[model samples]
Target: MRPSDRVTLEDVARAAGVSRATASRVVRGDTGVTAKKTKAVQAAVASLGYIPNSAARALVSRRTGTVAVVIPEPDQMIFSDPFLTQTVQEISRDLDEADIQLVMVFGDQSGHGRRAAKYLRNGSVDGAIVISHHRFSGQVEAIMSVQIPVVFIGRPVAQASPNSWVDLDNVSAGRLAAERLLECGARRPAIITGSLDMVAAHDRLRGFREVLGRVGIDPVLLEGAFTAESGRAAGEALAPRIESGEIDGVFASSDLMALAALEAWRDRGLRVPDDVRLVSCDNGPEAAAANPPLTSVDNPTDILGRAATDMLRAILDETWDGQPVLVPARLLVRQSC
Candidate 1:
C-alpha cells in the first residue's frame, strides 16, 4: 500500500472476517477472544498496517492519558540538580508504563505557589505531581481547592496538616550522618544546612542535633542555599573556625554543598577525615565520583518518584485516603569521612 493510504480498524476487521468490536478487543489486548480469532485479527492488522487512533480512543474513554509534573524552580536549576533529574526520570518511566503522558511545568521560585495554584485551577491536565514544595506559597491550599488529585514530592512546610507526600526519612538521614562522623572519632562536628524554611532541611538538622546532643557534643550550625556556590561560601565562612581547631568535623545537608566544603578544605591544605571529617546528603553520582569520594546519605529518589506517582494515581483513581508515604535513607561510607 502507498504511504499516503491510511489503514483503519474497520479494514482489519473486514480482512480478518470479524466484527470491528472483536478486532478492537484484539488490538487492545483485551481478553475473552478465542486464540485462533485473536491470531487472525493480529495477522489482518499487520497486513493492513492498522494503527489505533490513541487520541480518538482517549476522547471516547474520557481520559487524556496525561499527568502534569510541576517543578517550582527555573529550568536551569532543575537540570543542574541531580536529585530533581533522577526524580523526573523515574516519574516519566512509571507514567510511560501506565500509558500516561507527562506534562512538565516550571514555575518561578518567587510567587511560584500562586502561579502554580492558578495554573492548576485552569485544568490543563488530569492531575499534578508537585516537587520542591519549600517554595510553596499557599499553593497546597490552591491545589487542594482545585478538586483535582495532587501529590507532593517533599513535606510542605506551609501546610500544618500533613497532606499526601512522598519523602525520604530526612530526620533519620541526619542522625545517621552525624553518627557516622562520630563513629570515626571526629570531635566538634559542625553542620551546614540547606534552607531551614523547608521541612526536609529542618528535619535533617533536628535529627543531627538530637544525635549530637545525646553524645554531649553541641554542633555549630550554619544555613546555606542548596548550591555549590553557597557551599563554597559556607566553606570559607567556616575556615577560620576550622583553623582555630574549634571544628574537626562537618556535615553538609546537600551533596553540592559537601563538594564545595571538600574543595574549601583542599584549598586550605587541610587533610580530609584527618583534620576535618566531612559527610554529605544525597548520594548522587557526583558524590561517589568526587575526589577521594564522599561519605554521604543515600535517599532513594527513584523509589520516591515512583511512590509519588502512585499516590497521585491513587488519588485520581479515588483509591487513596490522603496518607503520606515516607521512604527510608541509607548511609554510604567513603573516603571523605
Candidate 2:
C-alpha cells in the first residue's frame, strides 16, 4: 500500500490470511470468527492501523449505530441513587468508546414507560439494555414485545428463555454480611430489605435467613425502596424494637439504606456498634467515609453497568451465550460491625 493511501480491509484480510468477508466480520465486532482467525485479524488491524468505517459498518450490519438504556424508575430516583447513577455513567463510558450513543429512557409507573416502549419498538436504536425490570409493569409488557436485541442490567424476574443479563451475587453478599454481624456479637439481628418487587431484595433476605436459621432464630424484616429516605423511615420505625432490645443487629440491603438508618438510630440517642451492631451492602466510597466506616459487602455498580453493556453488544452481534453472568460478591470489614 502507498504511504498516503489509507489501509483497507482487503489488506487486513491478506495479512491475517483470512477471507475478505471474515476480515469484515471481525472489524465490525462479530465473534463468530474462529479464535485463531480473530487473533490474527486483531493483530493485522493493529499492525496495519486499519480503521473500520463506521458508515460502512452500519450499512453491513443494518443498524442505526445507537443503543438505548431503559431505566425502570423516575428521573429523580436515578439521579438520587448513587448506585444507579454510577451504573449509568459506567455504561455510557463503555459505549462511548465504541462510538455508540446511550439513550436513557424511564420506565416507571408514571405512564411514561408506554411512550418509552413505543419509542423502543420504532426501530430508532440498534438494541436496548434494561435496568430494574419490574414485573407486570406497563413498560415491561410493552418493551417485551419489541423484536430487537435486548439485555438487562440485573437478573429480571420475567427473563424468558435466552434473555441476556448480568447481576451481582447478592445472596452471597447477604450471607457474608450476616456472618460478619453474628461474629461481631449480634444476637437479635434484623434484616432491612429493599423493595420486595425486585428479585435482589428476596435474594438478600434469603441469604440472611440462611445464616439466622443456623441458630434457629428468625430475622426481623424491614422493607425499604433502596433509598436513603426509605432507610431513614425504616430506622425511625424501629425505635421501639431498638430501645426494647428486641433487635440488636441489622443487615440493610444497601449502603444508602444502612447509612440513613444509622443516622436515624443516632438521632434516637442510640450508639452504633455500642447500642446495636450494623452491617450494609455496596461498599461504595460513601461507606468508607461514614462516621463509623461501614462493615459492608462489595457490590460494585460500575462493574455491573459495564458487564450489562457488554452483554447487550454480544446480543446485537448475534454471538451471545444463553447463560446469565453473575459478578461475584465479597465482604469488606470496617468499624461498624
Candidate 3:
C-alpha cells in the first residue's frame, strides 16, 4: 500500500486468493468460512494493513455498529458528575464487548443541542441513548423526529415521550432515603433537590415527601442544580436554621451535592449525624469517601447502562415493541445518615 493511501478490503481479498465474500465472512467471524481460508484472509489482512471501514460495513450489514450517548449537561458538569461518568463508563464497556463504537455527545449547553440534532439527523449512527434531558430545547424534538432507534437513560420529559427508556425506580430511591433518616429517629428533615424540571428529581422528591408526610413531618425543601456548588450554597443558606436546631436531617438529590452539604455543615462548626444527619442519592465513590461516609440511594448505573444497550440492540433487531424498562434503585446506608 502507498504510504499516504488507505488499504482496501479488495487488496486483502486478492492477496489471500479468496473472494471478497469469503474475506468478509472471515473478518466478521462467521462460521461458514473454512479455518484454512480464515487464516489466509487474516494473514492477507495483516500484510496489506487492511482496516475495515466501519461505515462501509455498517452500510452492508444495515447496522452502524455505533451508538450515540447524549448527555444534556454542560461539559464541566458532565465531567464532574459521577453518575454521568459511571453510567457512560458502563455503556462503553458493554458496547466494546459487542464490538460496537460508542459516540459521546454533550447537549448540556446552549448551541450543542442544535449540533446534537444535526448529528443524529445525518444518520451517522444506528441509535442513541439520551441522558439528563432537563433542558427543553429543540434537541429532544429533533432526536424524536429521526425515526431511528432510541433508548433514554432516564425518563425523558413530556416532549420526548412515547419513546423507550431505562431508568431506576427513582421514587423508591427517594422513599428509601427518607425512611433511612426517619428510622434513625430524625424528626426535622430538609431536602436539597435537583432541578424540578427533570423527572428524576421530581420523582425522588415526590417519594420522599410521601413518606415524610405519612409520618406527619413536613419536610423542608430546597432546589439545587445537581452540583457541588449548588449544594454548598444551599447548605450555607440553611446553616442558620440548622444551627437553630430547626433542621435535624438533610437529603440532597445527588451525592456530589450531598458531599458539599457535608462540608458546608463543617464550615458552620456542626458535626455530621451527631448534630445533623444527612443522606443523598447516587451512591457513587464520593459518597463512600466523604467524611462520616454518606448514606445514599444506589441507582445501579452499570446495570442501567447494560440494559439500555440491550434495548437498543433489540430495537435494531426489530425485536423491541417500544417498551420502557425500569430498573429498581437500592439504599446504601453509611455514617452520614
Report per-prediction Cα RMSD to one decimal. 3.0, 3.8, 3.9
Tell me the tens digit of each residue's lDDT in model 1 across 1-337. 5778899888889999999999999987778999999999999988878888988987775567788888877777699878888999999999999888998878556774677767776757788898876645665565556656778898776555447888999999999999998998877989999887678889999999999999798899989877788898999888888888999899999998989888987899877877888999999999999987999999778889899989888887778877899888899999989
Q: How close is candidate 3 to the true structure, as a TM-score?
A: 0.84
Which candidate number would show the highest TM-score if scored against the true structure? 1
Compare candidates 1 and 3 on lDDT and give the better one. Answer: 3
TM-score of each: 0.86, 0.84, 0.84
lDDT measured at residue 96 in model 1 versus the true structure, 0 to 100: 95
Give per-candidate clash totals: 0, 0, 2
Instruction: Please say which candidate is ahead in lDDT: 2 or 3.
Output: 3
TM-score of 2: 0.84
Runs in model 2 deviating more than 4 A are 1-56, 110-113, 137-141, 159-162
Candidate 1 lDDT score relative to the true structure: 0.85
**Candidate 1 total steric clashes:** 0
Candidate 3 local lDDT, 16-114, one digit each (tens): 999998998888767788888999999998888888887787778877778899988888999998899999999999999998899997764566367
Please write out the lDDT profile of model 2 over residues 1-337, one tens digit for every residue. Answer: 7879999999999999999999988887666899999999999999999988877767766888899989878677889887888888899999998789988887756673577778888878988888876655444556767888777876776444345778888888788988998899888998889998787888889888998799887988889989999999999988679899998999999999999999999889998888888899988899999989998898887788888888888777766786788989889999999
